[model samples]
Target: MNMSIVKKLKALHQLALSLTCSALLSLPLVAETAWRIDTVASDLDFAWSLAFMPDGRFLVTERTGQLVILNADGSEAKRQAAALPDMFVAAQGGLLDVLLAADFDSSGRLFLSYSCGNLNANSTCLASAQLINDELTAIRPIFRAQPERRGAAHYGGRMVQLPDETLVLTLGDGFDYREQAQNKANHLGKTVRLTVDGAVPADNPFVNQAGIAGEIFTLGHRNVQGIVYDPQTGQLFSHEHGPKGGDELNLLSAGQNYGWPVATYGVDYTGARVSPYQRFVGMQDPLYVWTPSIAPAGMTLYQGALFPEWQGNIFVSALAGKALHRLQLTAGKVTAEQVLLADLATRLRDVRTGPDGAIYLLTDGAKGQLLRLLPN
Candidate 1:
């Protein structure tokens, strides 16, 4: 590349970053809502995710390494412990995500993403188990990140199972291993797809390629926390926590590289530039970026009949922002943004759309509460 051209590209990148920051920071921080709340459950110990069953019952994962079954109204049905073998409970690691399988009515199997190993050596993992007669049984490990890097943060344990029954999971860059995101030999900073039995899908983007992890579907993520599929449109969306100000909402596609340390909309936490490029060849840009950081956790697509007006909109749970974010979308593009539930004034953890067309939410902390939004 010529020197002059390089300088010009750098200048343009800086300008884009400046404009993005201004547009984001200037938005009004107004909190509004068009729904009423109902407390479904309380005193959950740092609840991370929930799995809803067809029988009006659900399962919730706690950061303390336990899974609890609850009734439709959030009453305790049972608690299942010792399911996550060799679980590592520490900062940003631990029992992370719980999701039910499509054949749950008969197979009784479910999936989980969690942290494994001790503080000195840890890694993100995926496991399967069966719920038989109110107890978790037949728990077995299916997958784990390669190399088992050390560090307690950046586990990135969000997951979604497609209608075809293929499982997708997100893994983080291990905080100290940001550079490995560009290395295909490892699973850092990547989204992976696997079969229900933990086998590598033959059609996976990188399968059969020498020196690459066959499970990886996409690479170059920072620390993804939220991923949801829009069944109506057949589109997948995910959001990741940025270093300082570059939190992003992306339209996910297989084999796409979403630049992280190499090209970011935000800088490092120490006020230094993360990279000099905002747009790079062969790298996909985010559909939406949250400057100043919202610390996104869970996300869901609204196709509910309860709020017909919000059909096809995206709902994201925010931790640092302490609000529920509603992003209006059209043809996979974010058209507008709105903030809801700011009055709650507590860190929000996960958001979901219930079968009844209502919105479900989980708050953060040791005594967190599960909440629901009903049309007023």
Candidate 2:
């Protein structure tokens, strides 16, 4: 072959190699992002809430008044029968939420919220205890909803601790007493703020009001199940179930009335109007409303590395809707919505982010499951 032709052929070969390298670099390393159930902790008896400890262990609450500790791999380590509270188990009433104290490592303290009383007379109550050697010791009541009423449902038992170490407990309007949500004198349908020790906060919205409960922070909420605080913005957000329809997600503020039965987008279970209006003067509006009702349960404002794209989004567990709903938020407003894990055909009860940046879920059933969601 001619010398010039040989050199040209070598140059062409180098260019081809470079092109191949470029093409390989542009190819996707991972084909897709998918969510999958990583583990089934057990056939839980109705997993209501899940919280992770600093050592990567987790505790799950069952609505039947059971507290279970599981290893990081979802293997049961111990079950604390003595931790069970004397709960009034009935329709929507029972042992509800469990949370670890912010200083749980140092104090060994945990909190539980449940319905305490018989079906004929019950109320939402908060209690604290020390967990030592698989047992909850020194259990004591911290707060209890006042004007205990007769009912089998509507115990808003979700609890959240703020950065200030103050606690917020949501109370439901006893199903038959929806009107009491508007009354500040009772704890019904209100979010009460208290110190970790259970005393009413000195700066609570109604602390100085003569006729109002000193613990009342906000009122007019109907069975709020999901409550979370955004540490980045210092804002509290909550979602509650409405009658028939009109589930709501609200940006909570001190002293604000989030209109419930008096001003709702939903109607009575019989399809009668709950209220002829969805808004009223002096009452705050929801940041978002689910017209058909999703039965919003557990919620968390996600800020994790598992899904960089999901940063700053909100994750909600849906019971009636039986799905996980993601809301993309911008400047405190939801800009988009997505439904996930609907095909599982299970009622999602709780959602939490793990230290590893993975997502966890609890299913609601007689034989529920603790599930972890991971990228596929």
Candidate 3:
């Protein structure tokens, strides 16, 4: 070979090697963080809610009216069957939500919501009890919706505590009686605010209104299964399931009507229009609405340190969608959205943030699982 040609070939080889090194350097030094589920516990029958105790133990509620306590690592600690109330276990009606009191460390009190009544009729009910020696003590009823109906579905039973330590409980519109959601005379499809002892708050919007339920904080919801309070902004957020479509996320305001059957973005299951208007003069519109329905169940505001990028966003558990939805909110409005755990192929019944900043989830089924999400 000629000397000049040999020099050219060596230079080309060096250039190719340099290009390859540059490309390798541009690659990420470490893999991007991914979510991983650690099955904390399993074999739960239709677990509806998961809450952490002050001592790092966790409580899981089975829809069949049982409470299961687990160790921090998700091992079975104890099962309290007698602690659960006499729930009317019909379709979608049973022991629904369980929550620790804001002052649980000192008070030892916990609250629960469930369906009550016999086959003829049933309604959503709230109760409180103290967990003493791993047994429920001083259990008593706090509130119950009036005029129980025959319908067995749409019992909204989610609870959240406000900054003032007051409680907010969601009630679903009886599937057969959605019109009652618009009537203040009933508790159907309403959110109620009460003191820790179940007394109506003096500042509640409907306290002085005649013929309206004194406990009512807001009216006109379909079947709200998710609720959360943001202490940073003092805002309350809730999501409810709609008929054929029209799942909604609303910034809950006192005394406001949410326009369920009156003004809805959804249609009936039979493909008929739910209402002629999407916005009524006095009804409030949702902050975000999902058409075709995500069947939002449990929700939490992500203020944990495990995922700094998820701070101030909303995490919602979707049942029918079988996914966890991350909703980006800026100044009370949803700016963007993303879906997580779509490949899990399980109906996510509830999502909660643990004391250690990890995410916890409850799967809904006869052989459900309690899952913990951590950095992979």
Candidate 4:
């Protein structure tokens, strides 16, 4: 044992300890912070979707027919948005989600989705309008699902605006219409891309197709209630409600077949087998599948500087699981999962990373609330 060798070994041990301490410092401190549930002065009437305005306020949509504004401190709430038109407030319908345009600060524009009805039929409609002084004006239907008038479920009413300035909207299979999901002629059970003003994007997958051309971006989705575009990777991610046991999270791609009734991971609500099998040729497999279904609703990829290490994580809100699931990923594959607010026992409905870099969540219930998760 040489004296020089001993000195070298001791130095290496010290270096290892220093590295370990530094790694610990970089880890998230989610457990250290006391989550303050601000119940007072909160008017979240079954709020579904939430988007932060550039001025630090939040625009939220209720499952009913109203849009409310929440101040930055959550201390004040008011009905800033006007009542929507022809909203079919039946089961799984009504006002679904709301989003502000990328240039909303200057344009004062916002988008909304809801089930529309008149003449004894109901259909899902995507509408856009100017939000002036908390009121919607110049409202126009940008897109509408075809073969309308089915049962009142599976609207798939969420919007994701891509960096290319194009907007994509999801539509469900319009209950009892399993075959429509595979039909390219209809907007039901499909993802459609359009311009900011509801015009079809020239580069859409079906831009030049024979029929139903210029709208269909992706086909064969079943009630995709959650959709988000990852800015870092420029990838689209969507989550949908399954019957009793087969909820799923899918990576969206243009013209790709995401087989719904033909190839599902879950069974029917009656406890009967829906799809013959989970895998099939040409069908895109989900990045993650939930067995005994979590009933996922909303999601967003974290990219803020508030939590540097959590920048790339995918945060999904689970209703049946009653928690927010954080998934760590590398190269578009999930490597680990952590369940947050598991003890809260609240059905987490929507999860989004705020402009302030904090994670905000909406709980699901008749009198649900808005929660913020900040790093301690």
Candidate 5:
């Protein structure tokens, strides 16, 4: 063979090999999978909140006051934490949230929030319990609402442990009771800081006050359901339920008043304008406002390897919208927004980033589902 011809033949072979390798590398992209709902793992009962154990098991709370332990693979469920105190379970009451203590491996401690008493006279309660194999032992009510009364619904129950070793609890003002939201004398409509054992943090906003619970860290929230700490800045961001339209996302500040009944960007369900947009002279404005109201429930800021593109974005479960809304953030400001799972249209109750770097969610329903989201 001629030297030039031999050289050309070798080049052609090299080009063909490169093309084949490219095709093989692209195969997985073309064969990507879709998100599937795990109906078998879910139930007719309302699964409200969930947290993962260090061993990968899940401790999930049902709205009816039952705590169940679910295997990692979505099989072999067991009741781990039992004998949850009696709950209101009326409009929005009942077992609200369950969280594993940061030191659960050593302490066997779990914190929870729920409403106690009947529909007409219910109040929010924050309690802690020790999980012993099959039951919750030494169940202790750490903080009870001041001037307890009876009513159903609206308990903001999200727990996040701050860098200060203080637990911040989000609480909702009782249904339609906007006045209580601004009152510092009570725990309603506030985020509180407490010790793991339910003791008041001395640096709390109202610790020096005579009548107020010293646990309050920040006051003036309506129905804050979503609370998360930005690990980057050590700041807490919370999202709350709105009346007809004006849902709010707030960067919670210590000792700051968040205008609720006094100021609002939305109105009442009957179409009456709520408190003026700027009610109090010193009230803080929401970082982001949802005019149509997404009805956000669970919230978490992403920091995982599975989807590096989603880092620093806020994930919120939308109930009325029946979708998961992703808000892009830069320096604590929302720069862009996107909605996921718009086709299924199921009410997304809670969203959390699993230890496996995958996104797991619980749907709201009599037969709600636990779903895992992956990159397509």
Candidate 6:
């Protein structure tokens, strides 16, 4: 955030641009796997996330502020639109993550995160809603990233419910606010923990601390889009996008700083280094890093028995890389990695392990698709 550093970085960036760099990661090749792709539904408008209902029906979110319901076979069940709260729907903002409550069967309760506000000022917001009679109603705000930002980019809206039903949501650092990520006063570039009704947990790491957001669960993230709770080891993991390079797979901990602009394996898009330190004191290092970034988005731990080899492995969907990465881990560290379903060649937005032991994916585009990776 210093002017002198900014000026120096600009000059360095210009110099780097003038030189050819061949180190950018190329898309991984499609490899043989124990799965085959099957199209379940298509014609979605930039599908961002998904949640399955107890009765086999599922919900999918469209970035343009639409909540679609689909049958078990991926058949169109409804076309109704949930009321969007005047959200900014430009490049990366809009309706993002959708999740079902633990008591969804009877309570009809659900939660979603979206970009709320206009182009001039906006922030990521988490809201709770209900789906009754296939109609989405009773929408209410639970939390909003503090200090609204000016741009439409970097609203990381990923959500996950822990074993105890506490909700954890990801927030982006609002490109211009990367410096704020290292700060604890606001929600930018952090993960927040909250109760089902939007109450901040009294036991949160930052709770009772002055000058810090009580809801903050972790800090110093750039734009985390993929997060998953691994029940086997009782650990939480997330993967975030780096600038030009330095995509990370991290082990997340409450109140811990993961290091963003202050210490990163990535450089700015202009090719200027983001920081002098790639590993600094008082910051947690990443478990694995994907240099030349894959733009990792959606992730899920394979808990299904259908693929014995894939069981316990983490499956991450990539956007820019246009491939699904399979990472095998041991003690929270990646032991092996591979690319799956590269032949699809589309921006994958989300991935999940369904109750039926199949891997599901939502592609990103105007004609976004709901696809499945069925056992071969």
The lDDT of model 3 is 0.84
> Tens-digit lDDT track for model 3 on 56-171?
99999999888899998878999877354557987798889999997788888999999999767889999999888888789898988877998789889999987667789999
lDDT of each: 0.84, 0.82, 0.84, 0.77, 0.75, 0.85
Q: Please report the TM-score between candidate 5 and the true structure.
A: 0.87
lDDT (Cα, tens digit) per residue for candidate 1, span 119-191 = 8899999999888887888899999988688879999999998766788899999999998888899999999
True-structure RMSD for candidate 5:
15.0
* Winner by lDDT between candidate 5 and candidate 1: 1
User: Worst 10-residue stretch by lDDT in candidate 5?
Assistant: 22-31
Q: What is every candidate's alpha-carbon RMSD to the true fold?
A: 7.1, 15.7, 16.3, 11.3, 15.0, 9.1
Please write out the lDDT profile of model 4 over residues 199-219, one tens digit for every residue.
987667677778775688888
Model 6 / residue 8 / CA error / Å = 43
What are the runs in model 3 whose C-alpha is more than 4 Å off? 1-33, 82-85
In candidate 6, stretches whose alpha carbon ends up further than 4 angstroms from where it belongs are 1-32
TM-scores, all models, native as reference: 0.91, 0.90, 0.90, 0.87, 0.87, 0.91
- Model 1 lDDT, full chain set: 0.84
Clashing pairs in 5: 44-366, 120-150, 121-150, 122-150, 122-151, 156-172
- Please, what are the lDDT tens digits per residue for candidate 5 over residues 1-376? 2322213323433333333321101111112234444443667368888788888887778887778787887775686434656556776777888888877799898888888877666787788888877467888888766656566767888888876566888888776677888887787788887888789866665777887768877777889899887766555778998888778887776677778878877788999877767446778667677768889999988886777788877889999989888877654456667778778888988999888778888888778777878765
lDDT of 5: 0.75
Clashes of each: 0, 0, 0, 0, 6, 0
**Between candidates 1 and 3, which one is better according to TM-score?**
1
- Judged by whole-model lDDT over C-alpha atoms, candidate 2 comes out at 0.82
After superposing candidate 1, which stretches have Cα over 4 Å from the reference?
Answer: 1-33
Candidate 4 lDDT score at position 183:
88
- A best-first ranking of the candidates according to their lDDT comes to 6, 1, 3, 2, 4, 5
